[model samples]
Target: MLDLVKLSGQIPGLTQHLHQESKASQERLRRALQVFGRLQQEPQVWQSRHVDWGSHLSFTCASPAEPLENSRPKIEPLKGRHTVVATDGSQIVPNHHEIAYCSLINVGRVVLHYGTQQWPLLDSLPVLLYPSVELQQNSGLDAEEVLALRRAQAEVEELAQLALSVPRRRTTLALVDGSLIPWGLEPLSGQEQRLWLNPLLAALERLRAARIPLVGYISVSRSSETVNYLRLGLCPFLSCECYRYCNSDQAPPCQTFAPLPDRVFWGSLLQPGERSPIWRSGAKVLNPFGEHHIHCCYLNVSEGSVGEAEIARLEFPAWVAADEELLKRALAGVLSQVQKGFGYPVALAEAHHLAVVRGGDRQRFFALIEQELIRAGLRNVAVSPKEAQKRGGIA
Candidate 1:
């Protein structure tokens, strides 16, 4: 069915293109490293500088000083009585060829109680979109916006469910697989804030009221918040005027620094069982949260004689970050979980397993929709002709 010979012919050029880009990136990295080292010594000069760089810069670096060492920090072992829960979500976008006029969001959740040896609990929730007349009429919204809303709703619902299900007496730690900050909300308008921000904030508040220690774990992150801080420090002029004179071209002060990711710097500094110092995220979008703003740190979760150590970015709310005991417990719980999954948290892996919607599932779902429509006495409850031809394999 496929031509392997023709596909194989494109490999050489693609390889060459990648090689050239990689070579250029390496050079840029080298230059960035030099600037990073220089800023490390003069931390005070840049520490107090304030810049309103607008929506493009989502986070600020509160602590530019080198990350603290945790060589022998108290790492509490999991009591085995505690509860670990994780949540993940998947979605199906509306397709024009399908008979249905709606989309779907499915959230998968897993709860694991260690030491008891009991089977882990699993659940999947499905939600129908555009169920109301008002919602269906708002067709001006793009696919990205619809998908984002679905994802946000799924996350909030999962968190709310966890709060209600887990008992207050039990020590519970909740893990979300990605950033706590909702994506694409940095430049939020008044309307968007009311529609999106309020719901997420309410969910977060509910979780906090329940006293559950929640953490967002990002594996292999490429965020450069720290690196950008260093860049700001390198600029001699004030934040407002610096951009006018220092453009990021092939020459000048901007070119001296490489576009190194924050992980690269932390990976070199952190040893196994250690975590970098906590840094407050200066994401202006989080300003509305007041005491519940986000903070982050880098953690090295590797064990044994692994060739390359595993590093992850751990993000938590300000309340959790401020408390040393809570932070340590979260780190220990995460480390224990990671050990079981071989560098990943087991709870998250199970949640993702339950959330994924396969191709066969999609086909069956559409078939069921068509059947229901026909049963409702609707005429022509069939897929578009073009879609039918494709499905029938006419070539």
Candidate 2:
């Protein structure tokens, strides 16, 4: 049902554009490498000093040691009977023309028992939001905003379940598939933040109170937090004001580091089962967390050649970062899952598998909804013509 003829004509032009951009990026990376080498020779005292770049720019940088030069720490083995749990969410956005004005969120969670005879458990929980004045109005939220709220709620609920299920004596590592920071709150109004972020923060507090180690795993991350540190060292201007207000026309010296992603730098450095040094996250979105600001580190999960290894970013709260033993155990649990998955975390993979809703599943769900509407005396229920046409396909 695809237009192969049309796609074939477009493929060559797309490929050519990508090739050109790749060449340009390579040249930029070369210049960045030159600056990085020079910055590496600076004294630790100079590198550690904080630079004020105004309120908008983050002053955070990598640890003083050359990230690449540091040797990988040995992977710690799972000591005793431990449990690892991960949660992922999927959603069905509200359809305006449907008989019922509602949306659905399904959260899938997996609890894996390591070094024990207990069987692994996998399950899902679904939440349905019905039409109401408060639910609909919510300060005139858009569709994306509504979805974001549901996602945050789903994650919070699943985490609460994990917190309640795990025993006090067991060493538990609770994982979320992505950043713990509520990034969706960045563009919204203050009221929206209170509505969404509060619940997630409350859930985090519960996990912390339970003394469970929680981690956010980001696979194939393109973050440049480390690269930003290298850029700070390359700033030639003596006055913080000059660098703070510098624009493209003024062209600060660190512009050469533009396209370098953090993964590229760490992938070259870390070996299998190794993790980079933890650094405090400077994401402005983290301001809401206050005393529990997020910290991040990179882990090389691949078993292949160093150049080809997959690097993942792991994020945790300040509490976990402060406790060395808890951090080590969490990292060990992640590495164990990654080894079983061959590159990714098996618990996360299983959670996603349980959470995803396919096209066939959607069709059956709607068909059942239609039947229910008919049985309730609202006969001749049907989808919008556009939706019908999409399902029927083109001849």
Query: Model 2: per-residue lDDT, tens digit, 1-395?
Result: 69999789999999999999878866766766665566556545235444345233434344432244466667754667889888998877778666566667778889998788898889887776766642545556676566766776787668767856978899898988988767666777776677676777777788778878789999888788776766665556664444356774655665575766777777766887788778777666677786567888888877787878889999888888888888888888888888877678898999998887778866676677778888889965887788778767887
Candidate 1 residue lDDT tens string, 5-81: 99999999999999998777667667666665666666555565533442333234444323433354635446768
* Candidate with maximal lDDT: 2
The segments of candidate 1 whose C-alpha lies over 4 angstroms from its true place after superposition are 13-33, 51-79, 117-119, 132-141, 238-243, 247-252, 304-307
**Pairs of colliding residues, candidate 1:** 32-258, 60-282
Error of 1 at 185 (Å): 2.4
CA RMSD per model (angstroms): 3.3, 3.2
Runs with alpha carbons beyond 4 Å of true place in candidate 2:
16-34, 37-40, 43-51, 58-69, 77-79, 132-141, 239-244, 248-253
- lDDT of the candidates, in the order given: 0.71, 0.74
TM-score for each prediction?
A: 0.87, 0.88
